[model samples]
Target: MQKKALIAMSGGVDSSVAAYLMAQKGYDCAGATLKLYDNPQCSQPGERACCTPSDTEVARNVAARLGMLYYVFPMQEEFRKNVIDKFASTYLNGGTPNPCIDCNRFLKFDALVKKAQELGIDYVVSGHYARVQKDPDTGRYLLKKGLDSTKDQSYVLYSMTQEQLAHILFPLGEYTKAEIRQIAQEQGFINADKPDSQDICFIPDGDYASFIEEYTGNSSAPGEFLDTDGRVLGKHKGHIHYTIGQRRGLGISAPQSLYVCGKSLQTNQVILGKKEDLMSSSCLVNDINLIPWDHLDGPVQCKVKTRYRQPEQPATIEQIEKDLLKVTFHEPQRAVTPGQAAVFYDGDTVLGGGTIVTEAQLK
Candidate 1:
């Protein structure tokens, strides 16, 4: 029997090319476009939402040209519950969250994997800039960074389980963004020249605060801004508008520059302080998922990244509880915000990751 792959086409140049490449390899291929948002009712005009009608049409066209079967999976409710609600809840709880990570963990990897199994597809493929390889030494799957550093997306994929890594394919992992576009153009994919989707599909305006407010029907009322010494610095628009390391747009005029350092959902306060106040020596990570092995036996020396696009820093990962980890950076890291993922890396290989819950107990 021929090997099979369900290409997770996002109607973009990268995913389109990914489908073409997998088909060229003689694997039986099908295109699956996940309708992440509700239909015309949720569609916003002229915004870069990923799961709009146009995207699905583009994907269907690509599949037709490839002479492959196509599928449209409506995932509005699942996405809202697993990704969007979690996103809003995290922000309301005074922590920044990466919904893209959650989407991969809950949607593509979890939901789509089940769909692929139901359809008897051997692999679920996408255009993510990451690689999965099996280690010969231990006979386990390993997730590695894509060759293109500028477009490396392994940061958002740390929650991938070994099983998910084994059954998924990322053909674009070996190619840079320029190369992927070139491949798409060569293949005459309709979206070859289409601009990349930049905004979160659910939030067309990129105004997260407004979206959360409207979706949850909750207003982010005005709050007080407090200095490090508990002094009232000024009033803030709301806690949702500010984030760690944010300096601009703050109306307060202080003797020196100040940055947002923390938030208190309980007191409805946003804290401001000097840049030094943003630095964190260590943090506690929960909801752990390790790719290579089951658990960390002892303190493992590795590099860690607290946010996507931030350079990985040297750190030691230690397991404190079954589902908790402690990441201590060699040098204090700035703006290590809770609810953001703490992805650990052993060079290019993903060691595993978890959500930063709080600053580790200061000793």
Candidate 2:
């Protein structure tokens, strides 16, 4: 009997191709699309969001073309609690949050994996640009960077536990973007030419402040923009409107350029500082997930990435507490933003990762 697999189809070319690949591999494949939200009537525009009713239609069409069973999983409540709420709360607390990571954690791996098990599926597959392999000696699954280094997504996936890695499949990990596109084109998939969704799917235009205001029904009233010394520079629309290291649109003209340094929830103030103030040599990360080894007994040299796209830098990772890691970078990293993930890598394999809580300034 062939092993059954549940393929998460997102109505995008990548995921549509994933479904095709899995079907061709002789797995009894079933395509599933997670409906995260309804058409949120944004005050800005009425155009349907990326994963809209039309997108679902496209996913179903692709599943039919692959001769597989299609199912739509209504995951709105879980998505709101796990992704949307966390996104708003992170910004409210003056930190940049990557909702895509949260979506993969709670929806794709956790929720969808559970759904797959309930259906007696042997594995849950997706189009993530990362690879999972098992170590021959330890018999443990290791998450590695995708073959296409430029499109590698291992940073967002570092939070995955060993068990989750054991059951998940990334069929596109070894394929270049061009190859995936060609596969979709050959299959005549409708989403072959679909433009990549750049903005936060919910906030299509990238106006996050407006989205938060409408979503939570809380008006983050305009507040004072303060310098690092506590002197008021100008008025900011709100703290949520700014992020660490943002320079432009401060609405304050000064002789020297200023960057958003910090935010004060107590005073409802946005702190501005010189560009030099954005560099940090150390950071504390909470809610860590260690891979390859259970926990680090001492400081270990590894390459660390403060943000997803930033090149990995030499660093020493130490397990400070049960759920915390202290990373000391060899060179000062710029804008090591809190609430973003700090993923550790040893060569191509993911060592571990955690949520950056605070960055320590160089003494």
Candidate 3:
């Protein structure tokens, strides 16, 4: 019997081509588009929102063209509870959260995989730009960066477990974005020329502060903007309106450029300082998921990426507690924000990652 696979088609070129590739590989393929959200308040007109009606239509058409069954899974409540609520609460606690990681952790790999198992599917496939390989010696699944370095998405997928990695497939891992687009165009996919969605699916306009206020039905109260020495520089609209390394819209007239260095929920203050003040030599990480090893017995040298878009920096990772890691950068890293993922990589292979909790100054 042929193996059955569930392909997650997002009505985008990458996912469309992913579905096509899996079908051609002789797998019994089915397509699913997750209907995550639809509130007008959450999205803007003319903005590309994931799981919208139009997106689903395109996905359905692609599935039909491939002669495979398609289904739309309603995941609005799950997305709200896991991704959106976490995003708002993280900001409320003075941390900047990455919702994409939460979505992949909870919805795609967890919920979607469960759904596929219920249907007796052997594997779940998607268009994520990352590769997963099984080590013949250890029989362990290894997650590696996609061949297309420019579009690699391994950082957001670090929380995947061994079981999830073993059962999931990323068909676009070996192909570049340009190659995926070309394949989609050649196959006459409707979304072949569709632009990639850049903004958050829920916050299409990119105004996160306004979305949080509206979603929670509570305004972020005004707070004091304090300098590094605890001197009041000015009044800020709200702490949620700022994040670490933000320089513009400070509403302060400083001789040198001022950036948001930190935020204090207890004091209801946003700390501003020079760019150097944002640098930190070490940071503590919680909720760690180690791929290469079960635990780090001692300090292991690897490159760490504090944010999704930033390049990885050389760091020494030490397992302080079972679920905690201390990452000390060889050189000071700037704006190691709390709530963002600290993904560690050894060359192209992903060692593991965790959520950043706090930063420590260089000794």
Candidate 4:
């Protein structure tokens, strides 16, 4: 019997080629493009979007070329509630949010996987640049870094469970970006040269503050800019406009340069301090998810990344309290912000990860 697979086509070169590869391997395949967002509020009628009409067109065309069934699953409501609303609420509460993670957790992995199961699909395939492997010893599925280290997406995917890993396939995991592009070019895909979506798809301009305000229909009020000593430095435009370690757009001049050390919605204040104030030796993580194992009750040496795009740093993982993990970096890490993911890695394999809850409670 042919193995049935549902390929998530984002209409990018990576996903288009992923679908092509799966079909070439003789998997019973269907293509799906998740409509994650409505037309960008600010985009012109004909503008391209990550999962907009144009993107769906590209996916449909590719599916046609490959002679596979294709469909656009309208998941805008799920995306709005799980991703966009979560993003806005996080910012409102003085925390930076990673929407892509929410999208994957709720929409792709949760919702789409359920759909695949109902349709009798054996596997859900995506173009994420990460690999899912099975440990021969434990027989547990592991999420590993892609062959292209620079394009590795294992960090955001650490939330995946062994079951999710078991049913998911990443055809692009073994290929590099250059090779994916070459495949797309040779296949004569229309979006072969399309630029990867760099900005958040819904907020293409990258003006997160404005996007939040416009989307929520409520403006964040101006707040006080306070120095490390708790003295008023200036008035900030809004609390939502600043994030940890932000140095530019402060709209003020000081004797020495200052960075955003913290934000407080309770007091509506933005705290500024010297760059050195940003360094931290540890942080606490919550909402933990462990892969390849059940718990982290004991200490484990692993590489930890406090933020996406930052290289992993050596750290000791300790279970300090219920639902909490303590990570002590060998060197002081700067701007260990709350609300970001702290993914742990052992070699290329993801041990697990969680949301950063607070700075390490160093007494």
Task: In candidate 2, list every pair of residues with a backbone clash.
Answer: none
Worst window of 10 by summed lDDT in candidate 4: 40-49
Most lDDT-accurate candidate? 3
Could you tell me which 10 consecutive residues in candidate 2 have the lowest summed lDDT?
Answer: 41-50
Superior by TM-score: candidate 1 or candidate 2: 1
Cα RMSD of all models vs. native, in order, equals 2.0, 2.6, 2.2, 2.2
Task: Give stretches of model 3 more than 4 Å off.
Answer: 43-48, 359-363
lDDT of candidate 1 at residue 85, scale 0 to 100: 91
Q: lDDT order of candidates, best first?
A: 3, 1, 2, 4
The number of the candidate with the highest TM-score is: 3
Task: List the candidates ranked by TM-score, beginning with the highest.
Answer: 3, 1, 4, 2
Shift of residue 271 alpha carbon in model 3, Å: 0.5
Q: Which scores better on lDDT, 1 or 2?
A: 1
lDDT of each: 0.90, 0.88, 0.91, 0.87
Clash totals in order: 0, 0, 0, 0
lDDT of 3 by residue, 231-342 (tens): 9998999899999899999899989999999998878999999989999999999999999778898999999999999999999999998988999999999998988999
- Between candidates 1 and 4, the lDDT winner: 1
Task: For model 4, name the residue pairs that clash.
Answer: none
Residue 45 local lDDT, model 2? 29
